[model samples]
Target chain A: MSEPSGLESLYRELILDHYRRPRGKDLAPTFDAESFQVNPVCGDEVRLRVKLGAASSDELGGTDILGQVTWTGTGCSISQASTSVMCELVRGEDLGRVAELEAAFGRLMHSRGLGLESEADEDALGDAIAFEGVAKYPARVKCALLGWMALKDALAKAVAGDSSPAPGPKG
Target chain B: MTGLSPETVTSPTNAHGLCGPGGLPDLGAPREPITPQEVERIRRDFPILARKVRSGHELIYLDTAATAQRPSCVMDAMTWFANNNYAAVNRGAHLLGEESTEAFEDARARVARFFGATPSEIVFTSGTTAALNLIALSLGELAQGEPPASSAVPHICPGDRIVVTQAEHHANLVPWQRLAARTGAELAWIDAGPDGRLNLESLAALIDSRTRVLAFTHASNVTGAVTDVARLVEAARSVGALTVLDAAQSAPHLPVDFRALGVDLAAISAHKMLGPNGIGALYGRREVLEQLPPVFTGGSMVEIVTMTEATFCPPPGRFEAGTQPVTEAIGWAAALDYLSHLGMDRLAEREAKLTARLLDAVTGIPGVRLLGPADPADRLGVVALDIEGVHPHDAGQYLDDRGIAVRVGHHCAQPIHRALGVRASTRASVGLYNTEAEIDAFAEALANVRPYFGATQ
Candidate 1:
């Protein structure tokens, strides 16, 4: 195979910038909802804390998440940057729209496809699209997706009201 | 013919001096009794040591724990057999077949002498892992009483225990875990103290009447701490447990006598002991071997075959099922001969001195911590250390740049690393051919590790 230029693109300055100075980095004292996610292979961890505001049932059913999302965790640059980008995208989106974004990001990270469903809003994903380069390096894909998976877990735990304290990051 | 002195043959320095200023050692140095110098010269007979690596850098191989570089004698022995005496052993009357069979059996005899065991007790294996697996499988058979029934065999009931120690390599530990899983047996371990020594008191307490088998290492590959085999064997006997010793590390460094150690069975790999890869030996007492059933059975091991049923050969042959690593075994035998010519006692002494030098050098460095026993006498020449604030892989890479090779990470003993409260440690191990000058260079390289890594005192 030809030498991969995507690997070089994956380590680009923009991605590292997000990693070094992540936006929306916080740990809520008490969360409306939270989820814990772990990348079992390399032990990268991320937790998503969400605060959902009251909304009409029709608004909830509609695919536009308009809620506050915050994240905190320890991980490699890819994981941290991805979490930062994810926080920016999902902060003001509806819960239903957040779930759809997570599914699309998973597919993109796994290199399944570049296209999201036509009905799903793609504009909210924003800088998270930069991680598409990570698909070329299988070993680093977990680093890129660690935060999104944590957000998924935290949302589920927040809804269930059974979120235990997130575990500390360790090798 | 001019009688060449043993010293002249052994010491490269003496040989070079005798031959000329820059040629091979002098053949006419003052004839000392067959000194270690003679053994040193014999080592030069192996050509791999002379090879260049990474351009002009001479290959400074310090990875004997992983596998040893083979000598010319071993390589030639195997190549000769494969090229000339090529045939299936024990099944043909042709000359090539007979020659192959003799070479294979002769290899077994050489290995038996090396380990101070009888040929009847030695079973040729693929490697140490396979040998340990064979023991576990055979023990499992006895515990279950599957076939080729022996009423005298000890039965492992639900509450019976198999004892091991925390310092064991995973190859030694995992097999017993599987054995315990298969039978209703309980697996327990004697914890290593902070100094990386097995706690004798805890070992004594752990081995009670219920303990069926007590297995442990002859030495820790991670810590390099030599376990007190005599005391541990006594403790195992007190509890009526059959002791199995993992001599993978020890067999390469010291003289291993299975009978003298008084263990029921021991496992050793040829590759670790300056031999070719893909061959190891399992030494079991004749009585014990007879009692244990064959784990893998198909060809070669069978004695009498019928349409419906087949009987197997006794002990060593029965256990050695399928086609063996015949040429590898022969090469291993040659490697043992190489060790024998050097004398194991002297080799151990040289290694002890190297270990002391390594310990002193590493401990002298600020922010560098040597794992296991700090005292040189307490361990083998294998030195495992951690430089403060620097990951082991980084240290390994740094050393690599300096042409100093060492192993890093948990050394495949993860539980021990966890117990020691470190993610990983770097190791520098020595072999028979290693010199004091080499040790000095290694120590010098290690001294530079902290500053290179930018670790604070």
Candidate 2:
């Protein structure tokens, strides 16, 4: 058989698995802050609730830990898959580490179909590396970045003592 | 390659260039649907039709409802006008200015003739959105209980109601909503049936003495259901209400006679009819247009100007404010000439067959649900579909990858989509130049969407 095309690479079985049976797909009844994000171009939406736990004290400035991340959304497979993979990767991580990973993924997207150079950055993104092909399509990058942007907004709202984060367009 | 003859490729230029100036072509009786060979010849005139997309796949553009592709002659006209006769219209005294002004006015007369109207009744605006906005704002001014002493139209008071259909494109719908809000008039709508057809049976109950204006679409951009204009006109006339038809979607595909339809006013965009962008025309009955107030006021649209006040020009000029889209108007006239030669009735009949083929192919899929009438005769070639387990954006992407470009989302008619119980849908609309092969490719590509998304059983 001929080698799989870029579209096939973008819709890998692992990505489809997360999209079809998403983890943390339910809304949390109680959360510190909640954010609803929408992709106006395609009308995809995600409402995410984030809970922050006590910060770890080992570092000079203790980084807040993510206690739970849950969301309810309706969107295309790329967005759904990105959100599910994000929840799996960052649920138990420190906020600082999550930010680092988010930044790394952003860099991967900006690479424009050329993925991360270092294995370390690939490891940081984990299954999100599957979205590297998706980033090639400038029109669809918003779909892949919806969840991460929502997470950042919800965290900011939680820090500001606001109960609801404003919904925003990511791309 | 079709290896089209050189004669057919240059026909639009010859037909338009040599036609007698100052007289409309008597486009005889409605012709039959074009044969396959005729379609091939028509396709040769559009350069974009020959191009390829991703990995050498041929481009199948199925998004004409969003915006129709321009024929080579339309582009040529715009370029030729801009390069040869570019000057400010109706203002300067230079030779070039007079030439530009003459070309611009000639275009207006051409557009008016196309719609069975007089040049005095056609007002050029930026596009359909601007044209509709001009009407709504002007009507809002009229409804404010004040008519200039020179105007003869009656005032629309607080208790008046403005009626519209749920199927109107946002351009037509939102402006009326705003007009009602500004004038304190009641805003009401005629809802669509289960199959996305407008419920004309409810018109008598909806329109009464208090109804001042009844605005609606000639054909829906999303559902493809052509409105029953005769019944709508009869009902609106019975109530003595002004009827405003949004012919943006219909004028390109069908023959639209404003006089025969007997509507008080209408709006059509050149870009949606295989013309240049940034140009639309508003058609009004001469007597009715004379009374409508100007929404926008500025330089070229005035009759007399003082330090403190200004008197407006005649009907068409009164509504057109500021520097107009002069070149776009000339391009629009050329575009009209192109469509008139092609014969709108023949194009409509051809599109009906293509609509049937698309409906059959898409609806035959096990999980596909069409948003409009199942009878292809009731619809045009605009087909919006909702797959059971695929988002329209995803379906759109799959089609795009296969070099089939279709429109996705609410199509700017959110209420109709909500009424049809879908947040968004995938639409495959056609233009005069589209082929049966493209329709088949669209259907074949759509069948693979569910499997690609891993949603198929």
lDDT of 1 by residue, B1-457 (tens): 1222222211222222221101222234333344467546745865676766532556666777777766666666566667767678777778777766776776787788778898999999988888899999888877776444443235677788999999989899999999999988999998888878888888757888998888999999989999999988898888667889999999988878899999988999999987888889899988888888899989999999989988989979998888878778777876776666556766777778777877777788878877799987888877788777665654665565556678876777877776777757888898766766777887777777665434554
Which segments of model 1 are wrong by more than 4 Å? A1-171, B1-43, B51-56, B146-153, B306-308
Best by DockQ: 2
| Model 1 root-mean-square deviation | 8.6
lDDT of 1 by residue, A26-125 (tens): 8767777666676654345677777766555574654434367777765556777888988888777777778888887887777733544542435556
DockQ, 0 to 1 scale, candidate 1: 0.08
Backbone clashes counted, model 2: 0
DockQ of each: 0.08, 0.57
Report the C-alpha lDDT of model 2 over B118-201, residue by residue, as the tens digit.
899899988888888888988878767555664434366777889999998999999998988888888999999988999987
